[model samples]
Target chain A: EAGVAQSPRYKIIEKRQSVAFWCNPISGHATLYWYQQILGQGPKLLIQFQNNGVVDDSQLPKDRFSAERLKGVDSTLKIQPAKLEDSAVYLCASSFGRTGGKETQYFGPGTRLLVL
Target chain B: SQKIEQNSEALNIQEGKTATLTCNYTNYSPAYLQWYRQDPGRGPVFLLLIRENEKEKRKERLKVTFDTTLKQSLFHITASQPADSATYLCALGSDSWGKLQFGAGTQVVVTP
Candidate 1:
């Protein structure tokens, strides 16, 4: 079976520019997540979706960042007016289950974004 | 606030030796602790998961130990090889759901 897939493995943009990313989770996976990994730091959860419904997005910057999972399979994350600090690796992950215990998450290669 | 910490210093060891990495946490009680390996320009791949109730778990040459009392987890790679050179991250389910909080990770370099 194929793993999680993402597009535009690398991206470059200027500050205040807009950018978007796409993700396709593993087949039959029920939970999807987006994370931001800054250099030398672990990935931070930005948003989570379970079958096209958001489960958590408390850390997401609502003012400029937004994400949606349409049809419960494919998802998109967007950042408008990007800041230099926003330059990081955006990773998409999918899990076999919905809740915490015993569920394993599989990640994609990630989209590396650089804002000048 | 909850915090997870891994040694920022990179671990260097000779091939065929054992590599031990530590993960320490504060202000949180996680039911399960997970370990992942990430290569440069790639996403993290899950390696192991040890539960709070379980003291130790092993798979092949990899071993993980969880000490809930100390709120710490240790990951060990036995008979290490150069292929084991990667950044290893420790994570926990921060919420009741599967939302995870990850540590900064410890990079291990296994030299020939």
Candidate 2:
């Protein structure tokens, strides 16, 4: 089976500019996740989607960040009016929802966003 | 608030040795903790997971121990190889919601 897929492996944008990242989860996976990893830091969960419905997004910056999982198979994360601190790598992961508690997450290659 | 801490400095170890990494957390009790291996320019790959009820779990050369009283987890790789060089991240499943909270990660360099 194919792994989780993410697009635009690298991106660079000026502060205050808008950027968007996309993710396509593994086949038959019912749970999708988006995480942000700053340099020298671990990935922080941004949002989670369980088959088209959001499971958690408490850490998401609603003022500047937005995410959606249309139809539940693919997801997108967007940052508008970006800040310099927003420069980080964004990762996408997927797992089966039924046994998610014990299942391991399969991560994508990730998208590196550089906010200049 | 819950916070996870791991060694920030990179660890250098000769190949064939056992490399052990530590993960300590504060403020929250987790039901399960996980380890993931991340290489430069790529996302992390899951290595192991241990629950609070379980004291230890092993797979191949990898071993993980969870100590609830100490709020710490130990990850060990025996007979390590150069290919095992990577940043190892420790994560916990949130008690309230079971979401994953990750640590900064510990970098291990295995020299052949």
What is the C-alpha lDDT profile of model 1 across B7-30, one tens digit per residue? 999999999999999999999999
In model 2, the runs with Cα more than 4 Å from the true position are B95-98
**Top lDDT: which candidate number?**
1
Compute fnat per model: 0.71, 0.57
lDDT digits (tens) for residues A1-116 of candidate 2: 88999999999999999999999999998889999999999999999888999989999999999999998899999999899999999999998876437557889999999999
lDDT of each: 0.94, 0.92
i-RMS values of the candidates, in order? Answer: 1.4, 2.4
**In model 2, what is the error at residue A18, expressed in angstroms?**
0.9
DockQ of each: 0.74, 0.59
Cα displacement (angstroms), candidate 1, residue A13, comes to 0.6
Q: What interface-residue Cα RMSD does candidate 1 give after superposition?
A: 1.4
Clashing residue pairs in candidate 2 are: none
Highest TM-score, which number?
Answer: 1
